[model samples]
Target chain A: MIRLEDIWRTFVMGDQSLHALQAVTETFAAGEHVAIIGPSGSGKSTLLNILGCLDKPTRGQYFFDGRAIESLDPDELAQLRLNEIGFIFQAFHLVPRLDATANIELPMTLAGVARKERSERARAALESVGLGDRAGHRPAELSGGQKQRVAIARAISMQPRLLLADEPTGNLDTHSGEQILDLLDGLNQEGITLAVVTHDPEVARRAQRVLEMRDGEIVRRISADEVSDANPIFDRGRVGKRP
Target chain B: MKPEDTFGYAVNALIQQPRRAGLSLLGVVIGVVAVIFLTALGEGARLYVTEQFQTLGTDVIVVIPGKTETTGMMPGFTGTPNDLTLDDAEALLRRIPEAILIAPISMGNDTVSYQNKSRQVVVLGSTPAFFELRGIPIARGSGLPEGDIDRGANVAVLGKETAEELFAEENPVGKSIRIGEWRIRVIGVNGPRGTHLGQNLDLVTIVPVATGMRMFNRTSLFRIMIELRPGSDIEAVKEKIEAVILDRHNEVDVTCMTPDAVIESLSAIVGTLTLVLVGIAAISLSVAGIGIMNVMLVAVSERRAEIGLLKAIGATHRQVLLVFLMESLLISTTGALVGLGIGFATIHVVTWMYPAMPAEAPIWAVFSVLALSVVAGVFFGVLPARRAMRLDPIIALSSKG
Candidate 1:
């Protein structure tokens, strides 16, 4: 379970303050699949970073499992992320030098897991992602699709309750992106809460629920079936402009 | 995280960029080698001096005229010090029962000519006990005959080099040679006694003490060398000699020197020299530490992404610090070991080449240098490790450079 109340994140330059997230608030119940869809500079990644406990809001009240996130120290926040939340990034983010199994075992190693148990769980995680045979392959040796699978395996190796993905399929070919989406859908069906941030409508179309954001504020909440008609959300202004 | 695990990770990281690691290691290796080799040389000089003193016999004590006080001037120049005469030497032999043999020494420089070959040599004046007391063996013929110290015997003993220079192929023994205005018979030639404390013992000529006093035209003896009986208390004998001289001259003008005190002071001087050499060598080690610091700083910036990933996964700041610190420590430790190997190998080769030097590093010097290098590693590693520790995971992960 997650909750936010009047969350605001601001960046201060020498002469101006930019509000990345302004008076925003949202929540996702346990085991639900939600997607935060927004164009560049809509603060979607910022929101995902906050949800993963990787960054703190400039102003907000965030509660994860009834515990106030603002009250925890940095190390405690790191511990929570290590054990309760897993992150998958657009770049795969697997350490390039480590093999698939080592990459998968990394978080568990950070958590001080036994070597034998870490190996066993890494193998299982790889198998679940259909990459068991590729456990010994490094990121450089893997295809874009396989690298994403390894990243997914690394995320789930710690068996976190919630998965936070920031542009998870943004770097893949369409076919590989579809396969990654199917894998994520399967994991969500297994009762793992999933939150994905993507500019791609096809990625949002698979989510059980979608929230469309504009100018750092959530503009609408819709079902996955309504994602095709959500183009007007981007067409409001500067649709082709880079942030 | 486990310490060994951290160590393992650090080692793995260093292996990734061996050239950088080796470059830093070179600094420490050179520093350690310089320290070991230089200190060993100082220790070798000390050992050589001690060996030379030991050969002269530890039981010998010399009573030199003039009180050697720290007057900030040449000894005997500040005061009209009494001379050490043959009477004082005889009094020491009479008063101190521990004096088994006493040889009063008088010295001068003269040209000894055998036909046309003439060589300037230091002429030593003493009885036959001087040869026995100094451990100077005879390579040919016999030493100075047993006679009274006051009797001027015309018989002379040639030093090894002195004999070679003056006599050429002819046997100098039983042959007459003129030393200055006095004609003396060559009774013996000394064996090859190498240089001791810079003085060449084999380039000297020995004659009767009275003969040297007359030849050099000196009324007082140069110094009295007293050999003690085995198991004699040297300190007690020295005190008795001083007392006898003070009673006769009514002044403690003569300074008594035991081989132990001479060796102790000489060793202390050499020890200080060794420390100074080591101190100079330690500067290079500090420079090497700076090199390590430079390398670690570069490594921290280069591996920012890896550090961020580790922190994201659950590595604490302390763990990150440990890994970086361990990396530097490993570099210094490897350098120290290699340097020690090279230093000892060089010392071995040196000793093999010159067996008399006995160049070897003291045990404490070896262990302390090791400890110093480790300290340098940790000390220099701190700043870079702290930099790595304080790195923000968000920025580090996002940073492209």
Candidate 2:
């Protein structure tokens, strides 16, 4: 679960301070899949960053799983990211020097997991993403879709309750993007809360709920159940159907 | 995280770019090598000079007619010229209880000729005890005779090199050679004992002290060398000798020197000089430290994305700093180890070229070089690592995109 109250993120440009997010307040329950949709410079990524605990709000209170995010120190916030929150960036952000398995194992490695368990779990995570044969490939050696899958595997490897994806399939082709979305929807069905920020309507349609934003304010909210049959192929998505 | 695993990551990072790593470490390598080699050189020179002083017998003491203000040897500058004669030498042997033997030496550089081959040479005047006191072994015939120091015997002994130069391997004993203004018969040849302290022992010619005194036309002897009985207090004998000579000369004009004191002072002067050289060599290490700092700054700036990525993966600021710091630490320490081996190899090469050069590095020199390299690493590695630690993760990561 996550809660926000009047979150304001400001940026100083030259002599003027520009407010990227102005008095934004929102909340979401556990296991819910939400998509934040906006054009460029609409504060969608900024809101996601605040939710992921990667950055602090300029003037706001953020609560995650009953703990106050503003009260946590930098290291505690980092711990939140390491254990409670999993982030999948648009760029994939796999350490270029590490192989896919090592990339997937990074969060657990930072958590001081033993080498044997880290590798075993990383391999299992890779197998879950259908990357069992590509565990040894580095990011530069993998395709765009494969890289995003590895990033997804890395995010979910530590078994975090909340997954935050900021345009995770933005760099990939449509087929790969659709497959990634299907994978995300399947994880949400298994009761891991998911949030995705996207410019694509197809991605927003797959989320159980969608928030539309412009000019640093959330302007609309919609539910996929209310707009059912928007995409028939994803209607069958669930853990049991995939396995 | 486990330290072993963390450092393993650092090692792989260095290994990924071996050439870059090696080039950055070159300054440390050169610095450590210079430290070892220069210190060895200084130590070697000290040893060589000390060995040369020790070549003359430890039991012997010299009474020179001078007042030396600085070092003990070389008695020219402020000396009050007076008699420290054969009589004074004999008086020490008679009056001092520790006096066992004495040799009064008078020396000059003059021309010697044989079979139209003439060379300018150093002619020494002393009693037969000079050869024994100085450890010059006779290769052929015999050295100067006893009681003949005052006899003014027209007999000469050729150095091995002098004899070979004058006669080309022919036996020079009983042969006549012109020394100064007198024609003397050669009675012996000194063996090859190598040069000592830059003095050419191979070009020496020895005759009776009276002959040398008369030939040089000198009234006072150049120096009086006295030998003490074993285990005798040299200071006591030196006082007595000084008392007798000063009693005669009516002033404290003569400088008394124990052979060991000369050796000690020689090593002390050389040791100080060597320290200066080592200090100079240490400056190069500082320069190398600057080079390491420059390379590390470049590495940190170039790897900003990597730093942000590490922070994103939950690495702390201290951890980011340590990764960059490890890069320099590994470089300097590894360079130091390599330089040590290279330094000793250089010493071997030098020793081979000049056998008289005792090019052995002291144990402390090797250890000091290793410690210095690590210190340089820490000294220069701080700034760049701090810069990396202070980097904003969001800015760093996004900047790369």
Candidate 3:
């Protein structure tokens, strides 16, 4: 569960105070699949960063599982992020030196998991993402699709409640993008809350709810039923598969 | 993290960049080896000289007539020289209960001749106690008797080598040798005493002090050597002897030196020389430290992204600092060990080459060099490690350079 009340985030650029996020208020219940859809400079990534505890709003009250994150120290925030938040970046951000398995096991290792347990858990995570056979391959050796899968496996390795994917499919081919979206949808179906930040309308259509933004403020909120009818692409998915 | 785990990581990291690590360690190795080898050579030389002095009777004290000054324009060596006559030796024997034996020595270099052999040799004039003080055992003939010294008899004691050179396996005792114009009878041959302080002890010939004074036309001055009573404090006896000499010579300038004082002075001079040598060697260590620093800085720059990644993965700032610091420490410590090995090897090689010259490495030198290497590592490594640790992770992870 996550809540933000009247969040305001500003950045000082030379003489001007630029508003990255302004007077935004939002909430998401557990197991909800949501998408924050906006064009470039729409503050979607900044909102995702705040949700993932990588950054904080200048003026806001943030509550995660009933704890006030706004008052937490940097260390405490970092610990919370380490334990409860998983991020899938557009660039994948896998350590180049580590293989897929090591990359996936990194967060658990940081959490001080025993080596044997970490290996077992990392193996299972890889297998779930259909990358068990490629565990020994480094990111440089992996394709764009395979690297994203590795990133997804790493994100869920800790089984964190919230998964934040920023443009998860932005760098992938169409087919790879579809496979990545399917993976996220499957994870969302397993009762894990998912929030995706994307500028792609097709990506935004995959979520149950979409919050469209302009400038630094949310312009509109569309329910899945309304968006599915409004966008023809969602109708094609409904025709081909059971929702 | 546990210390063992940290150490394991450090070792693994060092192993990963073997060339860099080896290069870094080479600096320390050279430093340590230089320290050990140089120090060992110095210590060995000191020991050899000290042993040479020790062979010359530990109980003996020599009083020379001279004034050693620290500055100029004052009393030079020409100051009223202490008149240490043969009577002073008699007075010390009669008054000082600590005096076991007294010998007055007068030495001169003169050409000596035998049948057809002629060579210049040092002629020593002293009492019979000179043989006991020098630890020379007569090989074939008897040493000077008390009667020989009292009567100023022309009896000579030929050194073993000198005898072999001059007499060529012929009987030296009962033969006569010419010193300048005086013909002295070879009454005895000294045992082989080897070289003491570069001087061949056995090569010198000894006769009576009175004979030497008569031959050289020198008077009222002689080097008085006194051996103290067994179990007696030499320093106390020396002070008492100095008082007696000063009273006899009316406190005129003179130099009196005990064996302990001589050894102490020698050790002080050796220690100063060692310090100067170590100071010079330290320049090499500084160059080595700078080499380590340069290598670490390059490593830090190259690993910037990895450092950022580690930090992002929850490695604390201190942990990042420690990783770099440990890398430097490993390099320096390895170098120091290599240097120490080289140093010991050098000493061993030197000893093997020159069996007569002692070459021993002191334990303290080894430890001190090791300690210095660690200090150099930490001192030179901290800057680069701090620079690496302070890098902004977000920016670092995003950096393309």
What is candidate 2's lDDT per residue for B5-38, written digit by digit as tens?
A: 6676678777877887888778778877887888
Candidate 3, A53-105: lDDT as tens digits: 76688998889998998888766765776677787877777867678987888
Residue A154, model 2: Cα distance from true site in angstroms: 2.7
TM-score of 3: 0.83
Winner by lDDT: 1
Worst 10 residues of 2 chain B by lDDT: B70-79
Candidate 1 C-alpha lDDT tens digits along B1-401: 66666777788788878999999999999999888988888888887888888877888898877777745454435466777777777788889899888999998999988888899988989888887787788999998887567788888999999899887888988999999989999989999987864668899999989889999998878788888998888888888887898899998888778888889989889978976887787789999999999999999998887787777666777888988999999999889989999999999998999886769887776897799889999999999999998897766776553
Question: Candidate 2: what's its TM-score on chain B?
Answer: 0.92
Which stretches of candidate 1 lie above 4 Å from their native place?
Answer: A114-117, A127-137, A229-243, B54-59, B73-80, B109-121, B138-140, B160-173, B177-182, B189-203, B229-236
Q: How well is candidate 2 docked (DockQ)?
A: 0.28
- Winner on lDDT between 2 and 3 is 2
Residues A1-243 of candidate 1: C-alpha lDDT, one tens digit per residue: 999988998888879888878888998999999999876778777777778787789998999999999999978987888888887877677777778998898888777788899899999999998987998898899999999999898888888999988778878899999999999999999999999988778888999999988778898899999897558543322211222
lDDT of 1: 0.85
TM-score of chain A of each: 0.94, 0.91, 0.92
Could you tell me how far off, in angstroms, the CA of residue A170 lies in candidate 3 after the best superposition? 5.0
